[model samples]
Target: MSARQARIVHISIERNWREVYDFAAKPENMALWASGLGSGLEADGENWVAHGPLGSVRVKFAPENDFGVMDHIVTMASGLEVHNALRVVPNGDGAEVMFTLLRLPDVSEEQFEADFRWVLKDLNTLKKRLET
Candidate 1:
């Protein structure tokens, strides 16, 4: 697949960037929003893992507010490998979340679109969780 063929999703939150960032970036809080997705922070704070439909995916994060991006290598149960990047930025009133997906393994455009839709739903869930 072409590297240019990536999925990007954005969500605006109602809380300040700091609050949103701190809540979402922390491991324990992630479980609150990303329940059943196998997403959480490791006890050592060195890495985060989100279990995709495939296998246990892992990502290492820098210190908070480091402006560093987290990378994901998700191996689907069907043996498809997907690469993902997640970044959060401050926007007026709250924050903007950016998610990109690439290197889909045998994934069709329609499938990708569906994945993006699911991601948006997830983000909305997060927004509500944070705003309330």
Candidate 2:
């Protein structure tokens, strides 16, 4: 199935982009702010296994880089893959974090909106954690 629908949920953190990226890019640290991974992540060969809000899933993340990209793909128990594009960009003295939320096939508008809010809440959680 094709995922043509998209929404970007973003937040501005009062911290350096590099610092934000450094912390958020680590899979083990995601559970601290990213509620979906509240159970945390553990190494599973090339990917990480997270017993998240969506049940157990395999996550493949992009290699660490200087460009502040935190992209990752989550593979569900049924092998449904969802690509998540996340980025931390410089915003004056602070940082802007963005997450692209895709409304996959058969997702209703209400569910998509809820997903958008969920992403925003997660970003805000990150902001609160880092800005402290």
Candidate 3:
């Protein structure tokens, strides 16, 4: 299957990268944008764990400079597994977060596209909340 990509539109609130990074990195703040995720945020080493619809999702965060990237494995409510990477890049004004959803070989492209769109909408909501 082909990879699915989506972009979240956002404007910068505070120009300081450090402030942006810290706010975005906090797990509890995730619910401000995303749905069906972001509760029970916990951190161990460089990883984060959150209770999700599927049960639990473990995220491995890689942070550099003012940006952070994460690899996510989510077990969906339907028992399907999804793997994706999320990249948060500073827009030089604020930040633009991009999610690249990888479609597993056996996964249907339609499913991947639909889910990716949902994620983008959620992220956009999150951006507006944060920037406000």
Candidate 4:
């Protein structure tokens, strides 16, 4: 079987890049905006876990840095790791947030499209929460 191509979904937020990055960089704040992670995050030793729609999943976030990189890896209980490459780049006085969604080997085109929609919704939610 051929591998599926990854896709990127992004949104522009009317907020300072640093403000958006600060809010997103913190793992604990995910549930506030991300519906998929609405169950929130819990510390589990070196890793973090969240009860997502799929089930309890482990979350590993990129270390804090000056750059607006808030990438994270969500490992499902079944051991499938979904890498979410999220970035907050400066756009004038606001910011542009982008997320790269990788299509897993077993995912069908329909499912991949649905995932893209979900990410877009989440990014919109993030924007609303920050801009308000």
Please, what is the whole-model Cα lDDT of each candidate in the order they appear? 0.66, 0.93, 0.60, 0.89
Residues 15-110, candidate 2, lDDT per residue (tens digit)? 999999999999989999898875899999999999977999999999999999999999989989999999999999999999999998788999
Residue-wise C-alpha lDDT for candidate 1, range 1-132, written one tens digit per residue: 344577688888878877777777766676566543565545535555666443565555445665625444444455555566777777776788877855265678888888788788778888999888
Ranking of candidates on lDDT, top first: 2, 4, 1, 3
Q: Candidate 3 vs. truth: CA RMSD?
A: 4.2
Q: 1-132, model 4: which lDDT tens digit per residue? A: 675598889899999999999998888898988889857999998789888787899988999988899888989988988888899999999999999888888789999999899989989989989988
Stretches > 4 Å off in candidate 1: 1-4, 39-45, 48-52, 66-83
Judged by lDDT relative to the true structure, which candidate is superior, 1 or 2? Answer: 2
Better of 2 and 3 by lDDT: 2
lDDT of 3: 0.60
Listing every candidate in turn, what is its Cα RMSD in Å to the true structure after a full C-alpha superposition? 3.3, 1.1, 4.2, 1.5
Model 3, C-alpha of 16: deviation from truth (Å): 5.4
Between candidates 1 and 3, the TM-score winner: 1
lDDT of 1 at 93: 69
Choose the strongest candidate by lDDT: 2
TM-score for all predictions? 0.73, 0.96, 0.64, 0.94
Residue-level error in angstroms, candidate 3, position 39: 2.8
